[model samples]
Target: MMTQMMDILGPIMVITAIGFLLGRSSIGFETRTLSTVVILVATPALIFNTLTSLDITPETIGTMSSAALLCIAISGALGLLVLVMARSSVRSFLPPIMLPNSGNMGLPLVLLAFGPEGLQLGVAYFFVVSVVQHSVGLSIYAGGLQLATIARQPLLYSVAAVLLVTWTDMPVPNIVMVTTEMLSGMMIPAMLLLLGTSLATLKVTDLRPALLIAVSRLGLGILSAVFVIAFLDLDGLTAGVVFLLATMPTAIVNYVYAERFQHNPRQVAGSVVTSTLVTFVCLPLLVWTALGISERGSGADAQLSQAMTRTETSLGATYTND
Candidate 1:
């Protein structure tokens, strides 16, 4: 188990470290361009391919979707309290605490830990985060609800297309599917490398608030995941994925939002760097713990077991069966 956990985390740390080193060495990689490519090209293809290819039913989608929304809502609720206590603006603080790095870090971690089915489920969670971040997160940062921003995200369109194809039993042309599959392959590594580069550029002027918020985000996330999993009856891989995601650090993009809105960019950058470094130390233990808990089997565990059994029985294919 320890070895497996290490295998999952080892490459991530190494790749991110490389990016960090490159940045420190004054090697100029156009991170803004890379970020745009990831968001506009690689990530959307990955999302579309994952969603379209997965053999998930509406129940599975609902379960994952519920988990995602619950995750965000609970985090946001706790963040509201934190904001009140800190007496800070939503623009400066709420986003980092409320939104986990579901795309760059959370997705890759789950993909490694849980495999393709797990990645599919992770995408479901990412979908909700993307929608919420583009819409609600933007609104908070922009000081008003920018409904139009949601329409501008390529992921949103990819999601819609994937859903339409999934629901209608429509056949995607082979060429398109192949193209997306090729692009999807690039998503994880690119995101991780991009993460390192982004970390390289982050400047932390104040460690006190950054550390406080970093701890608060991770601490509140665990509490929220526990409540949400039990309340929503998620178990097995789904529960494990939720728990792991709950432990993820703040998104690097929050700094972008902070910088765009002039809302304490240094503080946001500090939180990003602090939480990401903290994630490096915490992820292996957290993943191992989640796997152990899921294996022990409870309410959600039983459901997940039964669901996997049904899937395997019906399809004659193996599943995670843990």
Candidate 2:
């Protein structure tokens, strides 16, 4: 189990460390430009390539997406309850607790732990979270519903293109596939680097509020995912993917939104940094736990299949004797 955990997290830690070092150094790279490239180009290409290449059905995607929504809703409700009880600012703390770093931290972990099929499901969940973070999460900060935020996401277009191709049974040209694949290859590493650099830049102003939010985010987030998995009867690879994505730390975007709206950005930044640090400490256990759930679920499925076969054979034998 320790070896497996290292295998899953080693590459992520190494690349992110490099990014953190670079951020600490006087390297004058334009983070905004890199972020724009990721959002506008690489991310969309990655989503398109992964979804189209895989044999994932729309129903499977829908199920994962629904799970994502439910997890977010449950996490948000839990966070709200805690904040209300503590007399905290719901607008500032709620978004960080509810939304997660599904894009930056989640994709690489899922890809490493569960491989291509898990990536497909992770992408579906990420897509849903991204949409909600931009719309509903933004509204929470902006103090108004910003449904228009969804229309601006390139992820929306890529997913639409995927659905169009899937429904129409259109064959993608080899060149397009190759191009997207090449672009998609950079997505994970770039996002990891971005995560590390972003973390390096964030300052934890007040440790108390930050720690409170961080603990709430990870605790409520994981519990919420567990409830959703059982509630939705999710098992195997799907359950693992959902669990990992849901348990990620507060997203950097939450800080961005808070800074933009002047809604306690420092506190949000502190939460992002604190939660990420805490998540790293908890990652090994989390990975082990997720893998265990998947394995047990798979075992349960195999047993059920074997039992059903045995029952069928017994019925056939009795009918023949009759």
Cand. 2 TM to true fold:
0.90
Candidate 1 C-alpha lDDT tens digits along 1-322: 7789778888888888777777777667777888889888998898888888878766677788888888888889988898888887666889899888888888888888888988988887888787787788877888987767667899888988877887788988989989999998988888888888878888789987787678777767776777787788766788888878877889888888888988898999999998887676656666766675567566554554443334224322211231
**TM-scores for candidates 1 onward, in order:** 0.90, 0.90
Model 1: lDDT to the true structure: 0.79
CA deviation > 4 Å runs, candidate 2: 147-149, 298-322
Instruction: Summarize candidate 2's per-residue lDDT along 1-322 as a digit string, tens digits.
Output: 7788889999999989988887888877567888889888998998899989989788887899899999999999999999999889999999999999999999999999999889999998998898788888889999998767768888889989888887787999999999999998888999999888988898999998898898888878777876787788888889878888998999988998999999999999999999998888777767766776666674354543443344335434543673
lDDT of each: 0.79, 0.85
